[model samples]
Target: MQGLAQVPRLLLSYAGVQFEDYHYENPDHWFKEDKLHLGLDFPNLPYLVDGEYNITESGAIQRYIIDRWGPAELLGKDAKEKAKLESFLSIFTEIAGAAKGLFFNKEWETAKTAVIEKYRPKLEQLDKFVGENKFVLGYLTLADFVVAEDSHYIERLFPEDFKAFSFLGRIRAEFNDLPQIKKYYEQPKAFKGRFFPEYAAVTIEQ
Candidate 1:
């Protein structure tokens, strides 16, 4: 299963860049030990250590990967496309945060309906934006990876509603078909089990 935090790794894998895939199984190990020792300005999960660069935050890590080891077009071709990419990224982040809130607040059972209703219109808008395009923004961009990973959470936790999202499904299929991604999936990796961390009250595996 691909976790939302694994988005940067997915981008690196797609670019065929070699990187260490580290997993912290125990929360205490991170919060009590490694988090304190790592020289990161904001110690956090999914931080990337590339030479002298130590970056935290998933979005920043993702952009770094794209800029450093890129199929440069992933950043978008022009200013307009870049702005659209950022818009999609912002929406994707909103969706991911909402999903995390369900478990973080321990309101999955109670808040599920409102969560679905709130995001359905947003997803519908995204669907129209994507329409028949091969990718979001009409080309492959980092937002595609972000949306693809976030969609899995919706599919698993809100399957009944997610079924209507043919555009999302199409983008996901296209993402999986990429040669680098196909190769990445074939290799053994540690990103498995629940989508959220163990502390979360609710979990989903896809």
Candidate 2:
């Protein structure tokens, strides 16, 4: 499964850059076998080996791609715009952090109410921030993709809860409509069972 890699993958796809997609079925074994040879200071899964430049860390890798091969708009048009986008990204990360337990916990049902209560305020804040915008920063940007990706599992896990946040649904629809994104979604990489083993067992409501 792509996991953090999906952000860079989507950005690359959006830029129409042809790149290799590698999946490791046994990451632990692979790490032990190739870590030293990979030439990374701190080798990690989902690292990009672009010629001599090996980049680790999802956020840095995504920014590197955007800086080198981007539509520019994705990074924002100016300092102020970039700051706004980054701020949104920060908050999106916060929301994802707050909600991680709900997705990964074996006893999610037992604490579902408490989890919703804690995160609903942030979700509503996001809903208000996103009202009728074409993208998170009024145009396509990394912020939009980050937020969408983070929210996707929750949207699937709790459709009724997410449906109450109409703006999020609209953003998802708009983002999916992009030609490149649509193509990517058509044949998404299988979710890595190691990270999301229960994902398959969870049914998505239509």
Q: In order, what is each prediction's RMSD in angstroms? A: 2.0, 3.1
* Model 2 steric clash pairs: none
Model 1 bad stretches (over 4 Å)? none
Candidate 2 residues lying further than 4 Å off, grouped into runs, are 186-195, 198-206
Cα misplacement distance, residue 145 of candidate 1 (Å):
0.8
Q: What does candidate 1's lDDT look like per residue over 36-70, in tens digits?
A: 99888998877899998799987888888889998
In order, candidate lDDTs are 0.79, 0.74
Report how far residue 118 has shifted in candidate 2, in Å. 2.1
lDDT of 2 at 30: 72
TM-score of each: 0.90, 0.85
Q: What's the true lDDT of residue 2 in model 1?
A: 46
lDDT of 2: 0.74
- For model 2 the local lDDT of residue 8 reads 86
For model 2, residues 1-206, the per-residue Cα lDDT tens digits are 54688788888888988888877777675767777687887788678888888889888888999988988889899999898788778777776665655666667677667867777887788778877787777788998778667667667656786799776667777787988898876765523223344463433332
